[model samples]
Target: MQLKKALKSLVPPSLQARIRTWKAERAIAVFEAEWRESRRNAARIQVRRPIERILLVPPDPGTLMGALGDDAMVTSVVEMARARNPEVEIEVLTGRPVASEMAVAHGLKPVEIWESPHFVRDLDALLTKRRYDAVVALGADIMDAYHDFLGSAKMIAVVDLPARRGIPSSVLGFSFNARPNPRLAAHFAGVSPDVRFRLRDEISFERFGRFSPATSELVADSAFVLTPGAVADDLGAWIDAMHADGRKVIGINVHPMLFRDATDEQIATIVQRGADALLACAETARVAWLLLPHDYRGRLGDAVCLEPIRDRVAGILGDTVRHLDGRHRASTLKAVAGRLDGVVSGRMHLAIATLGMGVPALCATYQDKFEGLYRHFGLPDWLLLSPESFLVEGTFRDALARFIQQLPELTRIVGARREAVLALSRQNFTIFDDVAQTARIGSAGQGGSPAPVQDA
Candidate 1:
């Protein structure tokens, strides 16, 4: 380590960055080569049976900072599955000890297979030992190489391994960027044909269909079916008071993704601008504001990033503005969101929660995922704010004002499509039925009654 540090100190910072980039590219190339070769040599296992046991792989392995969105997906899937078959056994794979607690809290059996360096080997052992009838990989917009390429590769492997083993594996509803990483896309294209890839939107479906059309299907995000949990008493009362005063309560979620690649000074400036925009909207519309934090992942969490902006908004707006000071589960946050008249959110899942509750949301988008979400409501251009433009002076304030003004129209549109969206969201779990059918067809008279499948 000392020798490497000394060598790095001898090179220019610019040169070091170039070297890192080159190394990453080389690593991706190597992974792709190995992946293609493995696909070519993979032997298919045919052990068809009823869907009694399921292994759920969440996007995050669970850390000090957990992803509420991923939790929402996992919880939603588990609830829907149990509602269908009360006797189905579900095991959630956890990487960290804390993740086990999360799984247990949701009444799931936690399987620790991520502590080992040989992740695939450990996963294989767990599958063999546990004999999971199905593997459901929750691909919540992290299966691409845009960030965390190795993580993306691991997610792919989670589904690929089970599918190849004829254990009925599938990636749950997910989104893809406009231009995905070529190597990752290539690897996805080569995965077992039986492994299903469910894209959350038409845009992502179109993108993935380019190479993996046979396995890819269009579905909605699983979080859409998440049930709302109770909110804090004080927060609930505050919102009630605001409603009693005839004020429109609006929720806002500011995310750290907006500060990606930004300097400290730029981040501070952005926060100040965001605060200014919120203040303007609050005063202009006489609206009560709730500062919601969706992600709680340490420094990158929305709560930490929103602190400065929240402070600023509260300093002036005082009682009219409230920041969620504690970390809450996705369901509880959804409950809080459901009470609001409308929302302006940087996090997609928070927006999903609000929209799922028949409330309007103006999404400040950091990725290509939000467009399809808004499209689901039939208002494709329904006040979609770009993060770059949100930083511009007066832009966010104007957008927020416009969103508030058009709330009734947007709300009507959202309500009109709410049932359709829910249906699509529930379709995310139909992979269970698909696999169960395959089992029945592949092993007719196998001497066991298949687990009953239910509508989501």
Candidate 2:
């Protein structure tokens, strides 16, 4: 609309009107064609890297997978790695037990799941036991921990976290490559020397399933999963009200990462708010409750979708939601999102996955990323619990109502956002292609020298 308006300003009024009409139609066609070809090229680049033996370290289960998104990251990584090196071997190390089980279920060849306490020891054992050559740690885990624990791999890549913290120096220590956590990458530039910085924004999300069979199944089966268990004062009441309104609730059992390092009082405040939200939502509805703990004995009426995943991590839950097994985590979440009328929750990824799968989602967000994603898609009105507007009476419900009423608009906005995001993925793929080529050159250069194992 604006493009035509601008183009018409310089022409005669009668000619401008005609020009605007033609320009609008022509611009859309050109944009769409360019977008499609860009997506195809990006898909080729993501799988083009010959990642033959990769060890992926993922955030603990409850934490949102930044690089991985909703479908398991390890599964995507292994599949992409193998496609590059048909003989590629992939293994995953995760803090969350459920993540490990999900990785396997998602059909990542074979993996060894490790709790964080045992991360160092288990990593050493695996490194010694196999001929692993690469390591990929999701987001800031590479900066915070993995740099100290890397194996004798020739190359290591990290999905850069959002740059609000600072320029991540860790990427410089190895071959600095990045995924679309642009904020983190921006900060890292000021702090570290500019080496060959490879920005990998090209993400062929729609084509992800093509690279990994498990991802395809997960995408095909994804459903809405809601974790309304924020410690907000009215959570339980909200659940009860939703039930009264004829809503079918799916209980999500994951914990948030922001409060991971908070003080006890702060943590309690978040937990209580979560509990209130759950109680509100669960009371009026016969919610199909999915939990995380094996021993949770809560019976919110006759509706129970209990699928316990063993070796749980944190007990710092804000709300008292139930747990499902890791194996069923991906499928179950997908199933819930798919069947739901809609979702209103605090879980960021749950909402992200919901929108990605074409379901309308309302985020009761406590962080910038929540609003960031919605704003990224031009759906800022759908954000319920912005950091500035949380915990007020009826704020959550109003947001929920607004989202439900605007489902069609929300869906349209999400569709556009999906296309733009997928296009960004294609843009990033060009960088991945360059990096893969460079890595091969670096490997050849090193081949001139004897392969000597370096100690950390």
Candidate 3:
């Protein structure tokens, strides 16, 4: 069964799509069709055409929700790389078990995983034995730790989100009265020339560009390119029932951690506001609401907030207001979200994933990362923001009121802009492919000396 599924990936993408539709209709009993859906979405865009060998280095993984998010990000990157060069041989030097677990959840198989407690030794051993065409550093600090082992591989550094202390002191250069960190300068300086660096957004690009020695470009977060797979029939039945009653479904996801700093009154106010917002929307707009939990793990996960909100809203809407069980994976949440009319989430990744699926989602963002993404989607006002504001009396109520007003238009806008948003995401890897191929050509074109991992 696994081999048959694996062989399916080798078929042409158009045929694969048709095959999936045919299989889905026939109820062919495929165990993990969503994984195949993700790959099909991936095949729609590529940066190069045929990368022979590529190595991806991921950061230390987190628990369920975070891990799934990271997997989505990495998978998007890998698919983008594959788009650049079709039939590329890829390996994720998978370090943490969390990441590998996510790989299983996503049904991305034939993964070449290299795991070890001794990361440095394992990394060096792998690189020393295999000559990869390119090495994509998924995290910023990977170079600092593994500088010595890269050898001649084309190194592509991706500048990830929520950048810390941008415009590294090294780029300003030594002034008569000012000096930069030698270590920072040396690390970036040692990058193999022709190395391509990608910043997740324009804001990060502007912040990181001056310090980077390699050509840097702006690209959408890879998560925006991933597509969700199918959900269980039981869940589907719930969605069908909701729609059958002629009530549009609006999904709500509030991160429990959002209430950590709030007072008892403030927390209650926020929850009440969410419940009230649902009631108001349902009454005015003729809709039902579901509590969507994007993050499924940890002390203050989505389930924690979702259960309370469900209880609070249950009296108002009864069975019309149900919350999802916390057991579903992130992909499962996304699959269910596809049935929603629109979504309001505090979890940014959920918004991105849902929006990528062309679901109009409102975000309750708390960082700069959120702004760049919403801006890319062409719906800047779709987010309700600030942790501080949630503490202020009536702030959430006011915000929710505004969001309710925008929901209808927001949905239409997302439906219209979905293709453009995806096009921007694909641009990231197109630039990435150009960078990787340049590094590859440079290495071969010049018989380049081994890139020195030394002090600047």
Ranking by TM-score: 1, 3, 2
Winning candidate number (lDDT): 1
Candidate 3: tens digits of C-alpha lDDT, residues 231-316: 77876787789789876777888765675554556556657667666766566665677887766566456665667778877897
- Which lDDT tens digits does candidate 2 get at residues 1-456? 999888767678898688777765554344333322322322111222443455555543333232224343333344445546667655655445555566566455335434323333344345445544444543322322223322211112121111111111111111112232222221222211211222121122222212211100001101122221122234445445555755554443323333434454543343444445445554444343334221122332101212211112123222333333323333335444544456654555556556655666766444333543465466766455653233354554444445555666777877777655444323211222232322221110111111112111
Q: Any runs in candidate 3 off by more than 4 Å, and if so which? A: 1-49, 61-66, 77-89, 96-122, 140-186, 210-213, 259-269, 431-436, 439-456
Runs in model 1 lying further than 4 Å from the true structure: 1-51, 62-65, 98-106, 115-117, 380-382, 435-456
lDDT of 3: 0.53
Q: Judged by TM-score relative to the true structure, which candidate is superior, 1 or 3? A: 1
Best-fitting candidate, measured by TM-score?
Answer: 1
Q: List, residue by residue over 381-451, the lDDT tens digit for candidate 1.
A: 74788777656788888888898888888889899999999998998787665543233222111212212
Candidates in order have lDDT scores of: 0.75, 0.37, 0.53
CA lDDT of 27 in candidate 1? Answer: 57
Residue 171, model 1: lDDT of: 84
